[model samples]
Target: MATAASRSGRRRGGGDDEDDRTAAMRRLRVLSLHLQDPSPSSEAGLAPAACAAAGRRRATGGADAAAALAAYLRGRHRDTQARVFEFFLSRPDLQTPVEMSTAAHRELCFRQLCALVREAGVRPLSLMANDPAEYFAVMEAAGGADISLGVKLGVQYSLWGGSIINLGTKKHRDRFFDRIDNLDYPGCFAMTELHHGSNVQALQTTATFDPVTDEFIINTPNDGAIKWWIGNAALHGKFATVFARLILPLQGKGGDPADMGIHAFIVPIRDLDTNAVLPGIEINDCGHKIGLNGVDNGALRFRSVRIPRDNLLNRFGDVSRDGKYTSSLPTINKRFAATLGELVGGRVGIAYSSVGILKVSVTIAVRYALLRQQFGPPKKPEISVLDYQSHQHKLMPMLASSYAFHFATRYLVDKYSEMKKTNDEDIMADVHVLSSGLKAYITSYTAKSISVCRESCGGHGYAAVNRFGALRNDHDIFQTFEGDNTVLLQQVAGDLLKQYQEKFKGGTLSATWNYLRDSMGTYLSQPNPVTSRWEGEDHLRDPNFQLDAFRYRTSRLLHSVAARLQKHSKTLGGFGAWNRCLNHLLTLAESHIESVILAKFIEAVKRCPDEKTRELLKLVCDLYALDRIWKDIGTYRNVDYVAPNKAKAIHKLADYLSYQVRLVAQELVDAFDLPDLIIRAPIGMQSEAYAQYTQHVGF
Candidate 1:
């Protein structure tokens, strides 16, 4: 079963008989790497040219590899876009001590971060480091809407707000934006209440209009109704966009406050000159967070407070001079929908943040893989961990995913780019869907990648200095903050269901008709058998079959999700209705992400130009596709793409990936655009570090 007969051809390395076998053979070598013992190779057998080539891919040669990466990036994707992924990275090797010395961690981190931002000209990203001025300028420049600086305003009820948050109109902007920029009135967004966090409709804060004085009396009726967990509220913010029930006299036309629904009111919390709480409002800090301590968080309490009638944020829904609540939309729910839509900015921001986190993680892991040596022989030589199949198995697929998601993020941002300039509602709605789906996928994945990279580093991974802990802390909120990943996935599923409903109503004579006709058979078809099994890429020389298989499974999975969701909706109700709906839609969102990422990654591989790099990555993509399929192997059992021997076959592809990546890790991580300091794991730092350490340790 395991025969190895060389063909009568001039071959540089071994290959399996079939394309899938050859592909799987690649994966096997990659995984076998993890099982190897730790040791340095004193004597190497490969020729100089081959070793040099391998070095470029593996990070065995530092500055030279980085330079080559810069050159490669200048040509790939956008001809002018530099692969500047590593720009935000700081060295991961230092230990974190609570108190710092003159030349401590903080100073070193700031120096590297600012330098990367300045050198890369990525001003939009400087916000992560809390450069207040640049953060807002780019947000406006990007035409973004109400967003947050990841800080909430007010303690006891001082109010929560962020720079990214929207100020209702030119009036609100005139009144507050300048104060924020000057740090005079930093704020918190008071949308969620203790009683209702995700369910905005259920928030208990209230604003009852006092016709006697032409002011709104904002009050926290009880403890359950109090505003809580507001970031930036502890110290910085001076105002909050408070979401409260808008209670109107039954005779008056204000939308029902009890059922009057939630409305955003821009309320001032502290008197600017004194920094003291307003007469009726109280604030308390949420002190010490798991991460993101950079922003102050707090709680809020409001007594019967008075704010002018004009303070109601009513661009979408308004309050008249007499206290009548009138909205541009027909119903309170519709008006509420518009209000909630602004939160989409948070979704987009989180997606963008995920990109930042992943770039750093991959950089560290790949660089380490290239520098860490293990197993084989001091005479014959073991290999860089990059050459181990499992190393690439853990890191490479995620690399491909990063590429894919990057494209999707760019696509979403471009759409937002167009929407903000034109104020297009349709574009905004689509962006809402995209941001929701992407926020869910990217956040969920970045969390996973963090774990992977941590484990990839072994025991040393848990060290706080490496940034894994900090990155994890900063990003953990991503899963629940902007929106819970589970909930966002459900929303995406709902959007997909809505689309299906619209298509259904389009009948036999609309544009929907044409799409149905054009897509035709394949849209209604089953999984492609060749793609399901790994045989298509059994041979090492030709790779189209492997590529095609990846495409085939991705297509099948998406279609399957649609069909399943459509079927389940017919009978489910109540919790089941929501759960079934959510489950099916999550599947749809996952598939969409998978397809987009695979397509983009392949595009990247195609652009590599190096015959070997392309060939090797093609196999890596195969492994990604195969592993993806195997993950749902239980679901696709009836389908051709899901089978057994192929799993074993694909596992071998890991071996090939491990071997190939040894030569490609440098190139791959370089494309990530990380700086050397941030990638400071002894293994990830430089070619000399590995050599120096080995010599120092008497290896």
Candidate 2:
């Protein structure tokens, strides 16, 4: 065994070698010089004067640029966000408490939600129907204030009320819309059963038509049929948009009823006046969850609950008093698809709200990084943690991702709005696929990124008051609700394969899938040698190059997965092949979503009217694209699409861009326009973070 000094020397490639020691000391001296000034001196490997001039040129336009970028990021709903955020700021009671019991948190969340509706006058239904842009903006603002409050509001308006608005006819809407808007009818969306969550088509709950009584008898056939994880069901919800298999009574006696497939029905779960559980409904608390204790998740079971015939949300399918079921969709599968399609707004809302979470988390982490300083060169002031390359690598890319997701989710919201306005089947289909993909992709990303943010903040982050714990716990369920990320990814994969097959039939592809048509020939071919080897900063920064690389990866994955499935079907059967290729299918779906996000980010950057803001966004876009490319360089290398030298260049460029982004990281996070009131973390304060944090921790 060697002594400690000898071991360290060996680790540095020179055990007891004087020459090596000298070289190492020289290198340290140069590094110290660079760290001391960081203005590109000769020791820092650049001409000081010229680089200093360039640095001045590249300096941020300060608050103006941040405000302009914030405007762009807010899209068409800036006024809504400003108003809502101001309202939240004014209401100190709405601030999330540092400590509370589950019941207390739930009650507080509910009261805050009521205040948003009654005091703030946020008419979610009206906004959704007339101004979806403002609707999402309000949701995003609510989420930024408190994740639980945002989710509870979403369950009330987007899921429960939206089901009535989109799936129900005028009668249903008239009965529920005003009540829901005014909080007179707090409701639950009772869709997910204990045993069959993602597989909605296989739900075991039944709603039998009683023609004689002119009512539908809803029942939970087994424990597995109990509606699980239902928001507001534990206490407040008076009604639910219950989804169950519609069973039509047979014409003759002693005959089995006809199962008319799944349909939505308005079922009363509790007494509105007294807030008591209805006669045939049983509600049980889900107990403590990892996060989001404020949402009051509960299990609901219906035992032969009876409701009038008109309770059925029959926009797509309806049953007559004589027990005749009719639908314009013709088939059970078609009707099921259409009915679920109407609820796509839930997924869109999840995606939008997930971005809100990302913004808040990133804002906290980046702000903390900017404020907290650690080691520095001898005889000099300590440097911010954000100045270190390693720190920048950790937080800057994620910051860029938060920005990327903002525009991506915004695009999803606009597309959803367009689908609603046009009601075109093709647009609806596009929205469905897009919403599912974004919901899964963005939520999962935010969930993981929140943890990174927590760790990036160091020991103080572990403090409950810092909010990482709650943010992580509350956001964890986003990946499972709306739809499980795995199931949703498979859905996206299935849609991609459908598009691939349709492309072969010379069908006109939707805007989202049109790239598949070109992928067959253009993307499947080997890369040109020149393009493969090109590794200049300008080339790597080009949006076209970034998008092309993304498209290539997605297309290649799509093609390979399609071929593999085709080949495996002969031996394994269709379902077996799909199971065997499940991992690959998920990869394909993720790649496709990444491509779409990059395209949207590029489009958003182009649409920026402010020159300074556009420049900043372009830099952010480059960081996002290059960072993703570097992470997936293996895929490009495997396909020979990127040469070895190019890969190395990409790695270097990504690091450099991370540093570049770190320079304006504060401005980027400030562009989120989050008030200190909403952030609520002493460590993430805008000024005097150390003082605030010490005071907060009782130092």
Candidate 3:
């Protein structure tokens, strides 16, 4: 279908020059592919561009489409305008007052964020949109209010399982629902201990059931057992969903919660009126953290804190007045999974935020590269820095990434929604693993991508005026909170290998299975038809036109390496027995990341409506796929055999691709749904001229 770009002749905002031509070429390739076959997805099975457009159409027709359209169009225009005015808004000319205050900058950013939050809140997609308690009364009334209100509160418990409900019996939900919406109370979820992070089995805070008084005594055994690093608990929160071991007089469980395991209780952290610690409660602020300063993090310790025995958050496990411990879920792992499953929402939130940050980064890099003049211009003075081959190599792939992550986030969001529906314990376990794994990967990618955006912006990127510095700080903690990346990655790897090993038969057929899956069509593989077609001969031995080329060869070569790993795994018994097979596991995870990215990049190119946008995105995707394949030529190849000449040629192409993308950076950023104020960078807006900034900043 001919994508009917608007009559303005500016379907995408930018210049008309050599850079435009380059971007156009890239787009034509993608558009041609889409024209050939207009299926929902590609050879490797990712959704095609048509699907995106179609989705957008359905989105507009949704029940609240009018409201969503308003939000989308406003955000879209806001972002585009922000990039256009990057120069003046950069604050380069704004003189620093003698007193030196930053009220203007702070207010500018806050207002921007507030607008963005409001924009997202009003979107048609219920999951994507925040269900504000004030706006959606039923959501609040049904106890689902926490889903959106929790995000709105920006509370310290970013992990997602927090409830305003006093940790009483499941019966408490009845009373808590009405009062919670009324703001009669506030709360936090305190599960992690100072000693162990991932290992929840080791918490030491103890809750002793006193059958005599019907009041449970919750006490921290030592300083280590104290609940440290609680967020809203520092100020806003009136109570906490505290995790401590349960001790019963009848049962022989020791004072150590480990014997009874961790049980959650509603413990009052502060006297709401005075903001003072309730009796026997000691609280302090965690001061500052690496990121997410909007939330007030805190430290809390309990010394014989007393609460009614009914104060147990008994959704999972419960205690009766008789000091009996009972749980709806039988297995301890299931209960544990339920406890941690609360983080799933957090993972979803981070995933959404990560996409936003990536889009912002791409916009800044592309716009700056386009307008910031450097090197030569035809007869008319210096050219835009985007003309530089080196520049394109840096920014284009990341541009491709912004698109890819958007799609991946869509798939991930759907998966999380499904996870929420199933009451099955087994399904919940899988959800936990999937959510944790994807969150780790997505957050890690966002962190890395944001840095690349910074570096792409050059010296300007390093400045807070560019917004990357701040966004980088915001994204930095994603790796640690929820779950540490390394730890989470290991867990993901473990889960992957576990699944793979379960099907491991006596035959070492990993290689055979992979090869046949492609040739015989048993793989049920994705739409990456080319990657599926590998020769029996090793890829390193071939030197055809495609092999000679870096990007094409990168995907092909990795496929071969992946084939080899599959063979290794099939032969290596269980993953546990394969002590020396860590490398294979690592590559397996990495290969999937490459596959998803490749699919998205190709899909974006195929489906993008604009001729220029499609062309620019194709090159970005190609460059990205190649960058991954050869990033570590040392470990990838047995010898440094890639001729320096061939390497330079590939780099040249990557540079060319980057240049094409840089021209359209402003347009791409605009599509990301950011408001101009939130971007808060001089080069972030669309309409500003470079000269204005250079003159103002004395550049």
Winner by TM-score: 2
The digit string of per-residue lDDT tens for model 3 on 350-424 reads 555566566667777776766666434224344455445456556766676666666555555545555555455
lDDT of 2 by residue, 585-689 (tens): 999999999999999999999999988889999999999999999999999999899999999888887877787787778788888988887788888877777
Superposed by TM-score, candidate 1 places the C-alpha of residue 354 at a distance from the truth, in angstroms, of: 1.3
Q: Which regions of candidate 1 deviate over 4 angstroms? A: 1-167, 252-259, 378-382, 507-524, 527-534, 538-575, 580-582, 600-626, 642-655, 676-683, 687-699
Better of 1 and 3 by TM-score: 1
- Quantify all predictions' global Cα lDDT against the true fold: 0.57, 0.86, 0.52
Candidate 1's residue-wise lDDT over 1-699, tens digit each? 433453433243344346657778777754443335211121222322221223324335445555554454332233112233222223233223323342243234333323333454543322422332233223322111001222221111112233233426667656654445434454567776777788888888888877778888899988888888776566655777788998775544463333467888877888777878888999987766676554556789999988998888767766677766676788888877777775565566568657656877777777766655556422445455655545766787777566556656755665655655576777778778778888888888998899899899776567665557766766777788766788777776666555555555763422111222233335457655665554434542233444344444444444566666556667864456556656555776666555555555566667777665455456556556555655665555655554666655555554454444445556666765544543544445646655643553478
Q: Is candidate 1 or candidate 2 better by TM-score?
A: 2
Report the Cα lDDT for residue 539, model 1.
47
Ranking by lDDT: 2, 1, 3
RMSD of each: 9.5, 4.0, 14.2
Which candidate model has the greater TM-score, 2 or 3? Answer: 2
lDDT of 3: 0.52
- Locate the minimum summed-lDDT window of 10 residues in model 2: 48-57
TM-score of each: 0.74, 0.94, 0.67
